[model samples]
Target: MCGIVGAVAQRNIVPILLEGLKRLEYRGYDSCGVAVNNGGLKRARSVSRVAELERQVDDSGFAGNTGIAHTRWATHGVPATNNAHPHFSARDGEQRIGLVHNGIIENYEEIRTELKALGYVFESQTDTEAIAHLVNHMYDGDLLSTVQKAVKRLHGAFAIAVFAKDEPQRIVGARLGCPLIVGLCDNENFLASDAMALAGSTDQIIYLEEGDVVDVRLDGVRIYDRDDQPVERRVQTVQAYSGAIELGPYRHYMQKEIFEQPRAISDTLEGVLGFAPDLFGPKAQDVFADIDSVLILACGTSYYSGMTAKYWLESLANLPTSVEIASEYRYRKPAVNPKALVVVISQSGETADTLAALKYAKELGHRHSLSICNVGTSAMVRETELSYLTRAGAEIGVASTKAFTTQLTALFLLTATLAKMRGKLDAEAEAFYLKSLRHLPTALQSVLALEPHIIAWSEAFARKENALFLGRGLHYPIALEGALKLKEISYIHAEAYPAGELKHGPLALVTEEMPVVTVAPNDTLIEKLKSNMQEVRARGGQLYVFADGDSQMSSSEGIHVIRLPEHYGLLSPILHVVPLQLLAYHTALARGTDVDKPRNLAKSVTVE
Candidate 1:
């Protein structure tokens, strides 16, 4: 969960690498370092921001034609300078083979033991150091082959960018599970863990798949598969903008992203909008005709979107649908037919568990797999046979708001198309939901206007340490998402219970200090959610209710009611999620936490 970027630029590579690292800081910010070899051997490392690291390089007058850098989120040790990356191994672990790693190393213990046995003492607690030594152990001084052999001994999800002293002109990168992008420029080339890392430099990028190793030099790059066979891949055009990924005009990335929802929703609806009436050109249903069931595997907010999709697919498409948390889905044997169609939903497309679940589904003999993801060139999209891309541009916030809504929007459209195929829906029922879905952006805009109200209520939450979110039916997933967003950003101990499951165990935790959020919008499940709220209220838990504006439920004396616009059938979750997103954002902001680059958290989890 770190950001790694390397560049061989026409100009001084240090400045370009620093610019890229600054853009990619949202991925990680614990520490930053860079190593560039211009005319001679020069190394720059620092314990602070990328700017400070750049300043150190400038002060030392270190310049290089080729370089690799890392912005870190510490997982192995304290977020200190010693633990920072660009760990070099030459004479006495000084500056020999410069290495920066982005994923976890699972075999670090065993490798560390062996390295110790080989008289290699470690500098930092990072698993990456072992890799630096492993490369040294494997390098019979061949930069490319050494990296290949070094990667062969390592296991886990990792994207490593290495620069050797001998091969000052070359940078070798290897991908095990983490996402990697190699971009082309006029007389220059770049390597990043994600396409967004190089969003400013180029739009054409070649996405590296699992077990792909690339040797990048001044003018060319060669990719090799796991078995050492040379492979050729194409550069795909990526849709990205300089400002879309920039930290424009906002106090924090979470806040900037929350306000970007209106535009994000619109962007996600592009191309697919105004075409749902003629969507998929009448052959859409036939495309999914062989499907028996849809097993949606996702994690976090994407999992909640899958939950809502399950309701839509079964209710609209009349197909049996099962939504599973990607973390738990593979542990148990699932009841699915060989003809079952598995749909994996992920925003980053590199979510570790969701990607694993997709692979597990394929191993189960599912003939077809589809990925519903926002990012265009994510591992999830590349690995799946059929896929639907949600045009929700780069979602940087760790607490996913727009991506979840967009994924739901795409899945809802898919449900409608399938319903039309199964002959389950005629004109009336079909047009109603699709038209309602098209208006979701406007409805979501209406909900976005409630941000100030949610922010006001957030003041009461900044002091609370725990929160309970409750909803039933479709709203249950909304509750889960709310809880997730709150916990992810605010660091609050939040829990979501299936309203019915309150009495089972969660009710015992209710207290005056614990804020209980009830998603009680006027739906068939309102009364049920109300009963759950009463259970919490009777137990002295602070109640904060988000209900429909049209509902006559009088505002409780002490409880906060975040009034919602008139409730629509299925678009309610899409609209209701806005306030929760704002609540989490404002709450985290109030706490003065690093809301965007939370500790030990990266935007994309490329490793399982």
Candidate 2:
């Protein structure tokens, strides 16, 4: 995935474009570039961070009233200056059109061959360059119509913004599968892949639908549908978190989000007097009643959350639950059940694979759908019939922290609601669960206090190249998440297994050099997990255990233990995950790796 931002303002838009790119840096940071319609087309490109590109713009004194910018996460080509966005289409040795794109062009090879036949020379090896050349070929003095025609010939997902040297003060944008928003301001209009990029500049935004093309000028904006018919879209006022985006008193966004878990869980649980079906939506009761099973569709960290929910939904609600990786769900021929509830979990809600899976489930006659998402304006929220908005503000870190915990909080509430609805939980049991949830914020605070201990462990872990995580029963998915976090941020090779499976195969990989991180909650599986730990000790493996305060496990010899403040019954997973997040953050810090923007990863996965 990449980020795109465009502006049609009378004022010099160089600063605005650069600032917008900075806000969207989480989406992409491999390379960045900007192109402006100055005297002709002035441009700056960098195969580095946006801050370096900004310095280049400042050194060159580049200024333009209309411009387009992009920050890229390398897809088609390597992260190089030649492959960066704001790609140009030249004719007669002069650049005519400049474009910034956010998705893949599947049929680019065909288009590139056709363009070469037309005597157009290509510069970069990116699929996006084909779009620029095609747009240039289709131009008939109308940039908007040309973009619309060019997109028709292209295949696969895309959201693009284009500006031409011949069309001053005019910019054209189109959205097919990726997200593109129009920010409405007085006498000036802006375009960005995400609304947060235009946070302070404008609150009013128009979310473009699929196959919609927009013509933006200093005076106004005009939109057209896929069939080339004039259409109007709703403009909503979104409260962009301009202040929360700042890293105040924190080393990185991952660390800040790791510490924000308590507050994020509290905000996500706000207004929950008690669990009820309507907490999701007005139609949730009917939908939940009709569904006999739940099929959770998600990817990456969100997929781990869904895996955690599968345990709750099956054990507490007495329902069959299945978790599928969103990217693979549609590719397989799954037995469709019309009564099954399709629950899609995503932090950004714009994750391309998850969104496609949700639509695929709907296509197979699954009527009941629910979305657990952080962004209220995201496509997943708009598409699903029932939804829970996790108030885990803007997650700037490529490795998720607050979003994961908040999703657990929401899924726990969903479990309670379903259990009560199905008569599996009585009034007294419901009250006890609610009280446990109410105590969660305080419980989370105590877990955060263990950061000092986790930081200490990270020092040892940072030197290791491999790790193994162990958990049993309901906590197994959390171990997977822990391993994912370590590998994602610290670049460590990590693996997780149900504690019993250690002896089957994973135990052979255990040795003194392999640090085994165990999630030893004080549950029914505690003794079995202890046996697993003894097995590791017998094999000369070092142990790092996150145990419950009352688990009675302590640091001795090769085994190390850091007890959590409380044994939170069914809700212990939420608390145990926080320490793992802190461990990953501190480990990344010790290893001198980028914690917020890990290598070869973007915060929001908008492309498959």
Candidate 3:
């Protein structure tokens, strides 16, 4: 993933560009740079943070009213000063054109070969440099037309911002697969890959559709379609609070976000006073009546959320549900049920594979679509007919915490709504569910109080090389999520398995050196789960269980149990995951790993 920001204003905008890049640091970046047309194109690039790039800009005395900046997550080349963004194209000895890009150019090899044959020597090993060279070769004096023609020949997902020395008062941007937006102002205009980058500067934002080009000028902005037709896009007011970007007292954003779950889940469930068929949207009743099956599309933690919902949907809503990994779902030719509702779940709402999977399902004539996402301006929300916005605010940590729980809250609501539509939820049941929903924040508070105990467990986990997580039925997804979190941040080898499947294959790997973490809520499967625990004990496997208070589990011998405040019967997963999250957080903290920005992982997966 990468970030782009461009501005054309009356005053020097290098500070604005740098600030925008700083806001985009959450998206993850390997290198960063900025290009400003001060008399000529003055650019500075560094394979470091935006702060380092800011110091370089200050030292170089680079100032201009029109400019473009980029924070790149390298895909095509190694992250170096030469491979950084704001790549320059020189004619003779002067830098004539500058370009910054997000996403990959798939056919850059062919284009690079052609440009090489034309005697355009390349200076960097990047697909973006190919675009810079191609644009410089096709500069017909009009920056907009030149970019439009050049992009017509390119392939794959790209959001590009290009500026020329001759057109110092303007910046041209084009988008295909990746996201791009235009920010409106009185005497200035802005372009960025995300609207959050423009939150403090402008509230009025225009989300550009696919294959749209925009010419940002000092006075106004012009939008064009793919076929050279001028178009008007609706400018929506972004209601994001920029204060959420700050880390107040918490050690890391992940810690702050973990504590924010109470408010985030409360916000996500604010409008729902009681369970109704229309809780998701106006068409939920009809969609539920028409579809007898559900197809959930998601990735990473979102996919696990979908998997948890599958249990809820089949049991509570009485609907047949199937969950698929979005990346694999799009590529495989699977059976498409015409009466199935395709539910897409994503925290960013811009996950490339999940979006493609949604589109692919629609292309197969499965028309019913819904998205449970946090961002309202994301492509998943824009493309889907039915949408639920999870008010989790902005999740900056690479290992998502609040976003995951808030999404689970939304998915549970969706399940209850569908159940009410199918007459499976009576008045008494609906009232119980509503009370549970209303009490989630309080339940989460009780769980957060157990952080000290979980931190003790994490002390033992931090020194371990491998771990095993076990659960049955509904809690199985929670175990998977716990394993994912431990591996993501702590870099420990972890795996999860259904308790009944221990004898299948995973039991062979159990040892005294490995810790076994179990989600042991009081449920129908508790007896079987206890039997599974005995098997683990027989093999000398140390056990760490987050059990319900009424589960009668104790801390003895090889078994270590942290009892829950109470067993929250259908909503137990929501509370059970909190301790596991704290476990992962404290474990990573003890290991001295980068808890916020995990290595080789970005917060948002914007590209496939």
Candidate 4:
């Protein structure tokens, strides 16, 4: 994945390009570059951060209305200054154009061979550079027509921005299977990989649909179909605190996001409880009021949210519910029907595989699809007939924190509403679940106050190369999420196993060097998980556990404990996940790894 941003402003372009690249650095940071057309065309590249690119541009003082910049993630070429993007091509004596591209071109090899056959010499080892050359070769003196034709010949996922020498007044942008957004301003126009890049400059934007191209300039903005006919679209305003994108006073985004969970939960619950006609537990039952089956699909941490929801859906709703990882859902032909409700869960709402599964399900004739997503106006939100919003704000961290809890919160509320609709909930039953649900915000506050302990424990995991996590029932899926977070950010080799399955195969990996993290709360699985913890100790495996505060513990057993609050029920997984998130964040911090932008990991996966 890579980040692309372009600004054709009324004033200097270098400053806006620089600031925009820095804002998009989360999408990619391996290398960066910028191309500008002042009096003459100039391009700058850097192997380090965006600052180096800015420095070179400042030294050259290249400024123009039409310019393109890129923060590259190094997919096709090595991470080096030369491989950095805003790639360019010149016709030796006639024309030149700079290009910044996102997404992989699967047929680049074939196109490269064809270009060479036509006697065109190549420079860099990038699929994007080929795009510039192809545009130049196919140009008939019209930038828009040339780009439209060249893009028609290309195949695979790509979103590209082009700045031409002859067309100095306008910027050309197009997308197919990758993300691109056009931001409109009174005196300028912009094309960026995402709306966040244009946050300071403009809030009104039109998301470029697949196979669509746009020419943006100070005087006008025009969209065209693949056939080059001009089309019109209404612009939508972005909804977010412009300041929320900034780090504020925090040292890192992970820490800032962790502290924001209290408010994030509240915001998600805002207008949900009273004013929104029971968003948490309402309308869900109406849709599934007579349904006899349920299927949910999700990926990564969101999958854990689905797994927790499965438990509540089965217990509370008394419905046969199944949760499948998106990838696996495809290979196995699961039972489905018009009466079944399919749920898709994602934080960014752009996860490639999950979106694909949702699309596939829709094509297979399941129209009653529901999506639980954090971001509004996402493709997933648009695809689903029904959507539940998660209150977590912009999550810059590659590993999610607040989004996970909020998804579980929404899922649990759905379950309660389903149970109420199914006539399974009595007043006492409703009151019990509702009271526990109400106490969650305070419970989260308590867990957040325990951060000092998490920070201390992180020191051990920072040096640890391998670890294992264990849980059962709802927490089993959360255990998997915990291990994934550790492996993703901290670079620790970690695995998760159900406590009951310890004797199967994973138990063999148990050693004193491997810390066995058991998510043991005072639930039905407590006794069984305690037995599993002892089995690990018998094998000289060190134990680190999150146990209920009132649970019994023995110092002789050497089971280090993280005392949790008193609300242990179906909703406990939501709380149990907080420590693991903290542990993973602090551990990655101690290891000195990039917590917000993990290597080879993008904040949002927009391509399959």
The best candidate by lDDT is 2
Instruction: Give lDDT for model 3.
Output: 0.92
Q: Point out where model 2 deviates above 4 Å.
A: none
For candidate 4, lDDT tens digit of each residue in 264-290?
877777664421214623454466654
> Where is model 1 poorest over a 10-residue stretch in terms of lDDT?
274-283
Query: lDDT by residue for model 1 over 416-465, one digit each (tens)?
Result: 77777678778888668757866777777788888878888899999999
Note each model's CA RMSD in angstroms: 2.4, 0.8, 1.2, 2.3
Give the range of the ten consecutive residues with the poorest summed lDDT in model 3: 275-284
Better of 2 and 3 by TM-score: 2
lDDT of 3 by residue, 433-504 (tens): 999989999999999999999998899999998999999999999999999999999999999999999999
Ranking of all predicted structures according to lDDT, beginning with the best and ending with the worst: 2, 3, 4, 1
Q: In model 4, what are the clashing residue pairs, if there are any?
A: none
Per-residue lDDT of model 2, residues 31-98, tens digit only: 99999998799899999888999999999989989999999999998999999989999888899999
What local lDDT does model 4 show for residue 203? 91
Best candidate per TM-score, number?
2
Model 1 alpha-carbon miss at residue 259, Å: 2.1
TM-score of each: 0.94, 0.99, 0.98, 0.94
Clashes of each: 2, 0, 0, 0
Off by over 4 Å in 1: 39-41, 92-94, 273-287
Work out candidate 3's RMSD over C-alphas: 1.2
